[model samples]
Target: MFDIVKQWKWYDWAMLLLRMVACISLILTFIELRDQFTLALWVVVLWELAAFSVPWLCLLLNHKAYWVTETVISGGISIYLTSIFPAAYLSFIVPAFLMAANSSGIAYRWTGPVTIVLIPLLIKLYAPSTNLILMMVHVALAFAFGFAFHLLMVNHRQNEIIRTQNTVLEQYLSQVERVTLLEERERLSKELHDTMGHTYTAVIMGLESLRSTAADAAAQHKLSDLLELTRTSLDEIRGYLHELDSPQEQLPLVQSLRQAAEEFGRNAGVKVGLRVLGDEYQISRQAKMTFYRCLQESLTNSVRHGHATRMDVLLQFELQQTRLEIQDNGRGTARIQEGFGLSAMKERASRLQGQVSIHSDSEEGTVVTCSLPRALKPADDVIKLMLVDNEPFVRDSLGMILESERDFEVVGRAEHGLDAVNMCEELQPHLILMDLEMPVMDGITATQSIKQRWPSIKVVILTTFEQKGKAVQAMRSGADGYLLKTMEPRELAEHIRIVIRGGTLMDPSISAKLFEGDASDFLEEKTVIAPLDTSAPESSPLRVLYDLTPREMEILQHLSKGMRYKSIAMKLYLSDGTVRNYASALYAKMGVRNREEAIEAANKAGLI
Candidate 1:
């Protein structure tokens, strides 16, 4: 592509060559004229050389500059030459071509008249008196024919150049289109993984926090079962997002994550390891990577936050599904909030129609497990998983969601939070998922009691209350994660596999909101930027209501109940935009002009 443009550098020479063609015919005429006049051959060569050389003067001027002055000089010289070399009738063709090629349709009409006068003058000089009239007719025919050829050649070459240029432009545009599609896919993938991912983490945290218990050995056994389901949910999320990232970023989910982990470990001066347990395991690209990214977050939590010294990765495959397990010997948090690690893992698993589970405790440290279907998880014989959720709806929803995933086994379900936690310990299950608000006991209170005795168990949360303030509280209480009930159930299964590997889930949107005061996240700081919105407050009152998302409007209603932007971003999972583009869009739709007027308009339209 580059070479084509480079080689065509001398764009003007093509036109110059056309003029040369005209000159060549004239040169022939001059030679014949010398014979008719009985002149020296040197004189003939000299006259013709001067005629051909004259056009080079046009090259000294810009494309259209000094045209009148150049034409006068050229025509006068041609007339003088014609008087000298009337077989210059051939010579006259030179100027004839110049005018035909350079001038447009009507003005170029003169070339015929000009050729007629010059051709006869030359014929009179070259032909015998008896033959003069007949020879003159031949000269007229030659001039007319030459002028017609020139007309076609000039326009044909012009179209050829245009066609070549269009071809090059089309290729460039095609490449740009390809790049744009790739970028859009990447952006969407990032958005999904970051935003909804956190909601899952919060939900997981709610469930994981309740794993601990002080009941009898059977109750302890039940708690262990809950942990198994919790750990596998993340792998499912990675498998789902893998599809979104591929064909665009051109990076496989597993490979990109493995490389990222190696880089992080190297950069942090920590030893992070990746292990594949299922020899013939295959999961969707998203499932593989979600587990991988979850590993990064879990290890990061271990080293930077968990303050652990070692981490382990376990991958298992079955004929129908695959399972991932990550664990570490570190002080485990009971509650997992909307942190980046668990959140992103949950999102990826959801996309793959998988599930995630998280388990943590002071004794056994922290464990994250993820499971995926062979269809969605990418490997036949992936691994077996025990399901735990008190609500039949939640359990059935999870089972149906994970039905497409291979290598995963539902094993059994626990009807109560306490029963789920008790079953986890007794079964010593690979993964566990517990609902926070279950009968007999809650997930958070149970996780604390279970982790005190057995730290190796992995538990994931699938709960409703995990959505808000309860999430942070659940984490502190002893849960490894807090994943939402609203997640596509597959995500809950995938994260469980990753948690089994001792990995962590990272949700991007949650991370963005974690630090409320950082300048780097300018648009994210609603309170800081909201004060700036004070600029329009004096001028635009009552319309500010349109700026909020429906969730934010709910938050606004809460603010009407007295809530704030921070609460709204938390509630809706939005990064506070400086100039709310959505608010502007809402304005036009709601028939208000700006944020202030929008509130009034919404009221008028009964939207409030």
Candidate 2:
């Protein structure tokens, strides 16, 4: 009860104080009327005591009924006191003010006028000599003050609600931006790890091979040095790969911050102190980065700009947010200019719905503070997965890579596409990592069948092939994504999650091939463009007279050869639906209704 009272606002205390004053006035009135201790006097005393007790009851119960009881008892007591003592009309003021303050809606608006009129009339009826005008004026003034206070409280509550909503919105936007940034970073990391790592390993191997072939002592010595340097470079690349991975299980924030402080102090030859307050809790990867960057920037600024020799760092983990404060005992300047480093630190913090504030003074030195909202940990809902590959080694390797992530559970495995389809029915996995050239049934055919049976099950083709035609075929056959086996294991796991989240992904190299807009790449044999004049008039009967894309022209030629839709799909390395769509567009452009009309029109044009 004491703690609840401590949490009460200023208005609550003010209302309580006002009620106490009214109760004290009633006690004094009772003392003055004690000489006539009759039934009426006893009745007045009881009424006053009930009015006093009602507000306290309302406070204890916190119910609308108690509040209504208080309001009624107080009004009745005020009216009786005013009627009997006449000069005791001052007691009416508190109840009128409380009525306006406590009530809302229709009651709030009408209570003031009713109290001002009704009380004065009752006073006039009982004590004809009482000053009714003065009583009305006092009641009106109390009501005005109470109504004004009520409006202020209402506005304050509205502002608080708006502030809470804005904070939530900012956090949501920041989370979205962080996810996008992390995905792009993962993509770049995967590219660097797979491409550069392989290239470096190959270089090292070639250098080692050359070392054995070198002739003479000097040549051998040079080869040995070159090989060593290449090895060193490869080791550095591997180190970078480790950093880029940024595994989910990282050191806690305190340990990370302590290590950073120690390293900075050792490198800069400055003394650093660290302090932590409150219990520690886990934070997101983006938040960790923000905190780290802010610390680095602050330390750098303290040494470079402030010419500081010693630094103090404080990390506080609060319920709402985690805060980091860095104070430097250095010669501070009067005005601080925000340079690129500070701007970058601010930008990074803002991206995670956090803030960084820096204060500097000549005497007080400099203090940099960063605050980030605590992120809630995601629930562990693991994705049920199955792997399908012809080779046992490939299936095992793929399973190992995917199972490293806690969110993925490899439920089953299959050596061939036929078995994959059969096991999928039994396992009912959420996703499948399938190889393209599997035995019995190909991945494209299996993907089509799975989508036909269970449209919700996502199938991603993971293979060494980067051919655009294969990727197109897989997508046409209802594969959710097409990826290369060269991708980093972690990146592959992330991509699987993306596919399950309704995203369609393709390897960057494959996407680039599709973007080239070359129709010849899709065909097994390139066809020569017909020698029809492209500058012919629109009225010309030749199909070339109508403007058509290169791909459209190729499809038109295929159609002119009396090929079926399935045959055209095979020849052009496309799906039947793709061929039909191209044919439909070609007919629309040539103003022909059907395939027979299109072929007849093409024959008359002398281009076939």
Candidate 2 regions exceeding 4 Å error are: 1-6, 37-43, 59-67, 156-191, 209-226, 239-250, 253-608
**Residue-pair clashes per candidate:** 200, 0
Residue 344, model 1: lDDT of 70
Question: What lDDT score belongs to each candidate, Candidate 1 first?
Answer: 0.53, 0.72
Cα displacement (angstroms), candidate 2, residue 290, comes to 16
| lDDT, candidate 2, 1-608, per-residue tens | 47667656788788878888878877776878777544466677778777877666665556455546755777666666666677777787777777667665666545656677876787678778788888789888988888787788778778965764454345335434644565566668667756765566557556766777877889889888887887788678666756765432266778878987886676566778999989887676557767866776677677766767789998988765788888898888778898877787788777665567676679666878787766533233468899999988677667655654546799999988889899988898889999999779989999999989988898999999998778878887888888999987758876776676445678999878876766444321111111234433333444444545556677777777888988988987644544665676678778999989987876676545
- Model 1 scores a TM of 0.34
lDDT of 2: 0.72
Encode model 1's per-residue lDDT on 16-91: one tens digit a residue.
Answer: 6756776576567656665654457676566555555554554354323323433444455455565554443344
TM-scores of all models?
Answer: 0.34, 0.41
